[model samples]
Target: MSRDATSSLAAQIDARLSAPGAMDAARFASFLGGQQRLGLTHGGRALCRHLRPYLIAEHDYAAVARAAERIAAALERVARRALVDAALAEELGLSADERALAALDPGEGPFLTVGRLDMLVTEGGFSFIEYNADSPAGITDQLLIEETLMALPHLAPLRRGRGVRAPAPHRALLCALREGYAAWGGREARPTIAIVDWKTAATSAEFNVLADLFSAEGHRALILDPDELELDGGRLSAGGERIDLVYRRVITQELVGRRGLDHPLVRAYRDRAAYVANSFRTKPLNKKAAFAVLSAPEFADLFSPEQRAAIAEHIPWTRRVRSGRTSWRGRDVDLLELIGAEQESFVLKPNDDYGGKGVLLGWQTPPDAWRAAVRDAEAQRAIVQERSRARTARMPTFRDGGVAEEEVYFDLCPFVFAGRMEGAMVRLSASAVSNVSAGGGVTGLLIVDDPRLKREDNRHV
Candidate 1:
């Protein structure tokens, strides 16, 4: 980045931090403790861990908007390409697991109707790190986290001075749910929407908040487990009411594992007895192999010029676990050899797990351990991605009864609905991983006096 640009960013951040309420760590912790009443706590602790917040400028927000468009396009291309030519999709490659998922009927919806794009901040804009269309868990929570932090008196100046506001993803999500009901031909003025997931899932709290939000919006919303549902005579009913729309939040594959895909919900969706926001088709793109399809040269022609450019610019070097010759930096290289040679520059992750499970950081592991992770990845159909340099910055965190300036690493995740960019989640951490589930913090969104930023982006919400 140019010196002026860097300094400009620093100035914006400083403006937010210069306030009195900027760094009360103890108060932040207490604030989190009070979130249980709001259903924002997880396992008895606040879901948002970072005390320091993100202060994004208007230009940075616009850049994220463009990045989201390109990402949505890329995901669409992959899903359509795979559908048009199953044989060609095979060439893009996958593990037996991902292949099976790809074969499943995704039903009639965008493969990734509602999901998130995890990215790293960069001078150019944002680096696409991972596409998470399958099971996006934290859209509402992210917004809530930001709002919770903004309520602090010390940070009140940032809101009053900069016109700070974070977009509510739950509102956009409701629109998508309503759209799904309409697609299912439901004529109810306000369809009964059920947030379907495992009864014991950690996100149950957010489900309650959503249910309340839906009630306020003129819809009867219910949070229930799949097992509690019954498909009697083709009508999927839950809690004694005929469900018109199902805002499915369960991991289809995992749910399928427990009860085959032919389960009532799956069958109901296929038969048009009900509607699912992210249809069954999203399971395919949920796999890590989709990244391989996005970055692999063999599949480059499948995407449009814009998509190809997005892949090249934002996506890092990535490949399926299988051994093969592939292009890297515009040239072909032996995949296994390169991975084995440069252990620190890579990471191995399970194609379908969440919450940082089965992820091995090469730089943090010993040589032997990295080799094991590489071999295991090949054995289980995993993905190897080049490590991204997620930027770090110093923030005032309350520690020991006073604000302590500490440096933290963070990542940006843009929430997309039907391939359209809506809002983003910011996860800050002291370590490399910035997932809230992995001890990261979420900060509020600030617009610096752009009231239109709220109204214009909020048309659908």
Candidate 2:
């Protein structure tokens, strides 16, 4: 859609939200209960219960499809780079244990594992910050919410468009997951799937979604707190049930810190007693250093000519920023000078943090804060990277009995199941931190139909 059309749509959305009084907590609770009866979990299901019908009308299918294709291609490229990086890490002695861990079979053990992706999309293109490669949420959430939205009384106009509606993302996700399992082994004897994460994590609803999807697919699914895990005789168990696969949602680093190597969960994972998504091997991809690696001249032989060109085109040129004294042009320079020189164009990031935490967008922060952050970066192995302006769209949200404007950025998470890129989960946020836990909202990505695109154009004319 054109800017005007998008603006108009935003207005419509705002008007709709303001048309009704703030939904009472009781009404919200009832809506949530209704969704639970339908087996939906996560904020996704709740949001879908309220917003799906509106979205059906709000989305333009053809534009979405075009966007999806572009985003998918970019993701595939990123995946290929990750595969190459994994190989390089192995050569560098950085990922030996991870390789061993990934080699374990799902059916051979009693533990479960999960995978995640941190993604962002824009009009310029989609770029993935990292693959959660360990534990990603919202699979179940995406489905339940979509289901609820489709059932809303307000969505008839959307339902009638484009002839046939798109399939539920949850169903698609289930199919992809089962296919991933089958590709690894089979479902002849159902694998005991568990959605594993912290009990108090804000996104626990994601676990519920995954559990429901697994159950619907005929797999015995359970949601377990990572703290409750146990290991015995080379098997992993949660709440006393043998776990066959773990849809891991916990940060491995956090897990490692809390349990040490002796924790039952760690022991089972290390012992290869269960299948883990993305494996521990996905660590390298999660490192901001990995972005630097993508730009290195030494790795030129590793990428295809096309892949090399694409990487060069899409990624910001990045480098490891180090501390200490160095001589340039026979003059000694300290860390402060180096940081000051590139403050406007660079972002300083800690190697292992996410959700935009501890990130110093040099231009956005106070000069003193930037200097302190840079000093900290020097102590840790923080990286300095060129900043790319993320594209934004204007969205209308209801607030204080009136329509309000917000700037939102899009994130496309293309789930890679068993090394193949499957479908996507799109997130939009008003803040730089697009994390759902940080108050970002999820939206249905519609691939615009050709007819609709033409209609949109005609309307514009």
The prediction achieving the highest TM-score against the true structure is 1
lDDT of 2 by residue, 252-371 (tens): 677766765466766665676765554554555566666666665665565556556556655565655675554333456564576677687668877767666667777787888887
Query: Which sections of candidate 1 miss by over 4 Å?
Result: 1-26, 88-111, 123-125, 161-163, 449-461
Error of 2 at 427 (Å): 3.0
lDDT of 1: 0.70
Query: Per-residue lDDT tens digits of candidate 1, residues 1-461?
Result: 12222344446555665567654666667767656667666545575544446666454566676767886777777766665577645644534444554555534555566888888875454577777776687777755665576566655555555344566777888777676566556789898888899988877887888888899999888988999888888898985789888888888667777987568887787677877777766655666778877877777877878778768878888888778787777777888888899888888988777877778888988999888777777768788898877777676655676655778887778888766777777776787877767766666544333433442341110
Candidate of highest lDDT:
1
Clashing pairs in 1: 21-154, 25-398, 50-441, 106-281
TM-score of each: 0.88, 0.73
Q: Write down the RMSD of all candidates, one decimal each.
A: 4.3, 6.3
- Model 2 Cα shift for residue 84 (angstroms): 12
Q: Which ten residues in a row have the lowest lDDT in candidate 2?
A: 49-58
